[model samples]
Target: MQSTSNYLWLLKDILGQGATASVYKARRKQTGDHNAVKVFNHVSYLRPYEVQMREFDMLRKLNHKNIVKLLAVEEVGSTKQKVLVMEYCAGGSLLNVLEESENAFGLSESEFLIVLQSVVGGMNQLRENGVVHRDIKPGNIMRVVGEDGQSVYKLTDFGAARELEDDEQFMSLYGTEEYLHPDMYERAVLRKPQNKKYGVTVDLWSIGVTFYQTATGSLPFIPYGGPRKNKEMMHKITTEKPEGTIAGVQHRDCGPVEWSKELPITCRLSEGLKFLLVPILANILEADQAKCWGFDQFFAETNDILHRSVIHIFSLQQATVHKVYVHSYNTINVLMDAIFRQTGVPAVEQEFMYEGYYLELDLAQQVHLVPKTTEERPIILVSKEQKAPIGITYKEPDVPTFPPMFDLISDANLAKIVTCAVHQLLRITKSIMKCQDFILRGVYWMLAILKEECRKTLQRAATLNLKLDFCKSTMMRIQKIYGPHSRMNQSDGGDVHMKLQLTVHFLATISQNVQNSQKQLDQIAAQWSNTNDIHHKDSTIGKVEVLLEKVSAIHQQLKKDRMRMKLQYNDEQIHKFEKLNMGIHAKKVLALVREDCEQKYKKLLTCVKDWMRIACDIRKQLRSFGEQCESLHCDLENCEAYLNNMFHQIPLKLEGDQSTTKSTASTVYPDQKCMEMAIRMKQLKQEMEHVTKELQQNNMIIQSLSDGQKPQGV
Candidate 1:
């Protein structure tokens, strides 16, 4: 045990030990506050005096939340050697966290994000101060619990850190072997003769290795034994770019890289996050420094990710998982609002639970906590209205049943059963074809009717528009002759002019609707035609039938031969013939035929089911189209009625001098035409809304069917 003037350190309370110094947990005498004290051995002082003070100076110069803070410089009472006291991180080192059983595959995504933000912040600060941390690894990063009960990682152990500009070069190698740059590794680990100089980008390589390990719990590049035991192979794996190699990971010496462009299966990060993270790792871990990303670009991308919304999985009481995008600083209420927008559920009636504990709105203000969950352990959302035990349930889609396999009792019986199945399938296929033909003819007939209706409606709308235009011209002439004060202009002419404008607008809308409906009908017809032609040929069933016929003929011949042999030989001779394995050979042939027939039957059944589904879908679409046609027909009738009323409301004769000026509007436009057009427009809108709702429902049905086709595990 050792004691200082203001602090006491016990030998057994050591926090960490390195080659030059041993860090021990210390307590301040006055306040009893715990702090970490770094006591250096005599050998550490033997280095250049400038080297001895580098870490202290660097720590003092840098001031950032992610960088550990230096409290005070102290001296050991017994040794009289210099020591440094810093803030104590209760959560210990990141290496310790990685060693835990849960993180054996790697840190969870939430934990990894904390590490990413912390390390990036610390490195950005270092860059601002023109400092490069050559040793950036898990062991040198410490985890501290913040005031909000969240993990905050901080950079520690600045022994290998130094002030170096981006363009400047450093020859002295400093880093862990696995994380060292290839150029530095050659000189440091391999002890090879080289005069290569490294720049600030060397730190990027270390950061890459550190991050790769943190995300996947393993290094990117490795050898047959290890990076240390097989130094030559590790250097080759890191430097050489063979045709099949990826990120310098090979299955064996001189072998191709084992990984594709994806992360290892052991990685715990989601596929979406992995997509964003892999490029960063690839650029930083480049053996050729020229290709590596600059610090500015690196920081920009990482910060962009940090600031963007994070996706989290949430389940509604053990139902399917829903992905919710929320920012890390967003509160639980914000998450609930997002859920409500996606699921149409009120936030107030929902409760969230995480890891078997109720996640309160006040405590879980940061959405970053939600990323720790997964599909299996998603944030369970309980509805206050439903009172049921929480449990996950999966419903598998119903698979179609096929004809059962025939028992191979005798060659004749097996052949007979296969032939029967083939005949049955052929009949079913023929019936399906007949149904398809009937439906196709019906669709074509309906299409012809709709096309004629659409053309007639368009022509009627055009005729009405022309009459409305002539009425407008007449109204203008009336106004010009009446000096804007005549009773015709004030009372009847003004109303007639307004009605003409409304009628024109409605005519244009009706034309547009007809055109749109025509286009939709064409598309539906094309889709149905394509689906109907999908299984136009029954070639698969025909093949099965042909094969069964051959097997049946062979069985008949074999039966004849057996009868002939029985007639030619005695009972004792027949027994000897049975012992010759001829019966076994015939049975084998029947078994083979049975297997082939079963497979063909299954395939045929699947095809039939698919065709039936397509037919049903076509029927539904046709039904919807028919309803739309009826709506259009009603719209046309209303327009005709509105035009007739308009014609009656206006008078054709002008009893004054205006009779001399040929009136264009005449009695074709009426005073009630505007109100009638408005009513018609409102009705058309309601009908369109109904059609849209029906389409939406159909789309939902299609989506459900598609989901049912996917594997249950998915």
Candidate 2:
């Protein structure tokens, strides 16, 4: 007998009944649209039907494709059987698709991604509406093919969801057996304390199972024969891993490949799907819900694993450590006390030693300054009526107390201080001794380690002005070889170069911190830069005395290392080697500089001297050539007079001894001789032209070499 209906009359279409609920295929009479209706026996549940009906209202309001819409609800007569009529899927649920693929025992990697996006989208919407669907599974998912050939997944049923609290706490339990979180399973089986409260992480567990099925096509845990029988079989499903004894079955031992010989159903999935899931998967699954994680924790833990994996993959880029025996302060005497009866290295336990010691010291010292339960010793109240007036009520003066011997300056604090100093000194000593390294950073091997150590100590330990002498020397070493043609110091170029500026900054920051600490001391030691002023403003000589003692201790350690150096190896030998090294270093630099300087100086000096001498010699050559030209002009005139006299004499002889044709003979003689002379004149002109060409060529030769200057002449 169904009592009320959200829709006017759709409840009459009951088509079937199952072990848990009744189902029907109904048509919305108003729109002629088909839908599936489910009737639940909400009568015997802890929550009332109204709670589920309200969730149905929320679903009905949503209009996303990937969400199942609750169209209407019908409530049964007083027994409170609630009914939900929801949108119908044509092809069926994703569970059927997984069972029907070609190689399709499971969804392929690509198909899984599409389905995952849909599922996550629906859940994200639910979350935005301030809800957590405590139950999520393949059965809860319905897939429909769109006209666009795309597969759509819809999430349904939020009966057990809870709204989160302001304090970030959520608790809920409702889902199918295979997808139920370990936390909810505990809540079902155990009475109370055994089932701890959990949060949205429960939804994540279901999501993990969903992803596993989506990828590999099968549930990681499938104990059959209904939820109760499955619950019995869960001891194996949840607790017993396929690997080994139950000790640490949840956490697998990593190997080179880090894959198990037997694969999880998820492992059988495609590689692309595995990649999509890995960044979000928490490495270990635990029955203890507290150890499980929400999304952020899942991301953090996965990132940590991924980072370590990268370091292992590219081990060459990361820092390498050797298995050397470095001395630690774990004394055998301190190891005898066991906090619990366990067997392991007591390193974390040893930390408690310092904590306990400091705590005890604090308690003891505070007792001296501040009283605790004074009546346990003695109590006498002064009365005004008896011995004295109220202001002077004490008849007898009480004894004044002074600080105890060790209370003034604690050895534990001093020890802590000394331990730090010892480690720091050891670092510097190692750096200083490796002079052959001459790397600017104390010792190059310890460079990164020391810098990080100093940074932590200064920043975390509140230490000021640690020694940076080694860092300074390291920079100088770099500066010494900074020029061209300098030999490389380290194999890795400038990356690890420990840039001098960075080193200086580290040292300078340290120095500033030290100066600041000194100012803090000045608060006590104000106006007392020198000794003998022991007023309230200045530190007492006694305190100064203790500081001097610590300084002396540091000095003593340095002296001991020096002696150790000598006794272990001869001082003279080390001194000689150091001197020889320094000399070789200076000599190499000097030789390179000297050679370069000498060559350049000689070249420049020679060029200058040659130019000076050539300047004067050029003037003298010009004067001499001018004089030669004048003498050649005079010789040419004398030659012309001799040729004229010869011509006149020859004509007179021809006139006296020849036939009576004197004028004609003269004309004929003149023509014959002139022709002969014309031949000779042509020859002379050729000779003059040849000589002129020779002169021009000589002048060009002089002009070319004239640019080349002469050395100073004698």
Candidate 3:
């Protein structure tokens, strides 16, 4: 092939091929610079000479960055065949980019904005030049990567293009079937042979189809097979407006329309962008040319979207969602500052995460350019500091004083006095010991049960965390092996990975809390055991026992003194001696024992109050752990189901793509680790229920003691 500049062009590779011509990746011999060359076949030469020169004339008249530049027009050296040389677009057509697995659903919001801007700019250039690109589709749009790594789409393949004002009409049938207008489809595809004259509004219909497909990865209108096989049905669905029929879709030939004004659920664009885009789609997708939007309105609406502030939703540790408005030019630092202001977390302590990766504060990183999807979880802002634990306080009950000791000397009958005093002392000592023993044993049992539950709960949480880690590693490996274009590298995969990470982190936190509770239980158990030993040796109950023995000995001595006075002395002498020795000694000893018992009983009350406080703490800890376990259980279930669905979808997605590797089969089934986690979750739930019942019983025991009622054993 030869160019008009006398430069020899070597066709190194075929870039693309169409019905009339084939494009090649050609290199100039002198400069060795790559360029795209279009070589038309003999079929194209059969057209009228003026029709053959139309594309060249259109390209020479248009000069815009969004339109592909025409380099040189040449001829084949042997066959005198005409050839067109155009500037090379390294990024290729937009269709090839959309064919990747990651974009099977749609382009991300940021990426969609780029396409919108580029296409609108190109169309505006066409309007200014009075040119109509009769064949406007994804295949005709070329992508060029700029120096800053940004994509710019340009219009190419202008073979069917011509100069026509908006009001002018041309009776030409050209364009792909799916993107064609209903009137054009009737004539060109259905072979109905209608003489309908097409105007500039036909391009608007094509733009609407292309835009919808770019945003949602599927065509808007539909029939049973496709536009080719179901020609009449496709034309009717696009043009007819029954009483209850929607515009874009129908279930069957006479079935009700199933279209909605909102975008499909599979679209990844945000609700904010959807709000702006739907109105535009509704106006331009109209089959009636009179109702469709003109180029002026289209440019105005698209430009408005480009200049508006970006909206982002952030969640603070999965607790609260905050809506923030950011300009397109703002940096990540500014976004972090905004989060700090809204969440009250210090900027230095805040860690922002989008998808599964932490966001860095790079100067060149725009806040609005983060790769996020509507179906994915919100951006998470986590605090570096630990939250304070929830706590409950209890008021200590007032101590009780020992009852007044009986005055034996005041009683006229000596035998009765001894019996009453000895009986009262024995009863008091037995009651005190029994109450102490009951409280000690009850508290010890509760502590032991709580400790055991903590241990079991921690073990289950550890197991679940391990399973989560395994699943996450497997997902990461799949992404690595598939490269960036695979379905595993999309935003959905990031969402799954982020959810798994969150579950694992939560399990680790709960495990740490359970361990802390166990330590507290151990401390309470050790303290109760020490108190039990003291009860047997030097506690208030032991002191009461010693006092009972002393009282008995005093009573016996009094009886002996009474017998001696009756046998060996006169009445007056006996009365005087009894008053001086027996009465004084009995009163002094009884007063001392009563004082000692009162002090010991007060110490015992303090100890029991301490135990009550410790028990309340344990109950609070148990309740907290149970709640954490419930949350972890829910997270694990969601993560498991999401992973299972992802695994099932892998094989189906791979079947459509011939370029995928065979290793993807390894991850196409549900993992055993998720099932193991499910089993552990069930066991953990049962343990939680058992612990709850034990806690209720413990509360009852504590409440009874607080009311000063005797325990069952006592």
Predicted candidate 2 versus true structure: per-residue lDDT over 659-713, tens digit per residue = 3444455576877765655575576456546544644554344334334433232
Q: Which regions of candidate 1 are displaced past 4 Å? A: 242-246, 250-256, 311-714
Lowest-sum lDDT 10-residue window in model 3: 390-399
Question: In candidate 3, what are the lDDT values of residues 1-714, reduced to their tens digit?
Answer: 445343455455777888788888777667878888898988888888988999999999888988999988887676678888898898888887776434655677778889999899999999999999988898889999999999999999989888899889899888899999888888988889776788998998899889888887778888767666777888888887432222367566666666567787556575557767888988888877887888889889889888766534443322333444456678867867766665667777665555445555564688668655332345555455432211111121111222233223332245324334433443444434544444454455556656766776775665566456546655664565356786667777778777777876777777777777777677767777777777667444444445445544554544555555443346434444543443444454345435654345445556545554554565566667677767766776676566556645544554454224323443563355445445755764565465446445544554455455654643
Counting clashing residue pairs in each candidate, in order, gives: 2, 6, 0
Question: Each prediction's Cα lDDT score?
Answer: 0.64, 0.42, 0.66
Per-residue accuracy of model 1 over 239-268 as CA lDDT, tens digit each: 875332235565666666554555775566
Which candidate gets the maximum lDDT versus the true structure? 3
**TM values, all candidates:** 0.51, 0.36, 0.46
Q: State the lDDT at 499 in candidate 1.
A: 60
**1 Cα displacement, candidate 1 (Å):** 1.6
lDDT of 1: 0.64
Candidate 3 residue pairs in backbone clash: none
Record all residue pairs in model 1 with backbone atoms less than 3 Å apart, i.e. clashing.
Answer: 471-665, 646-670
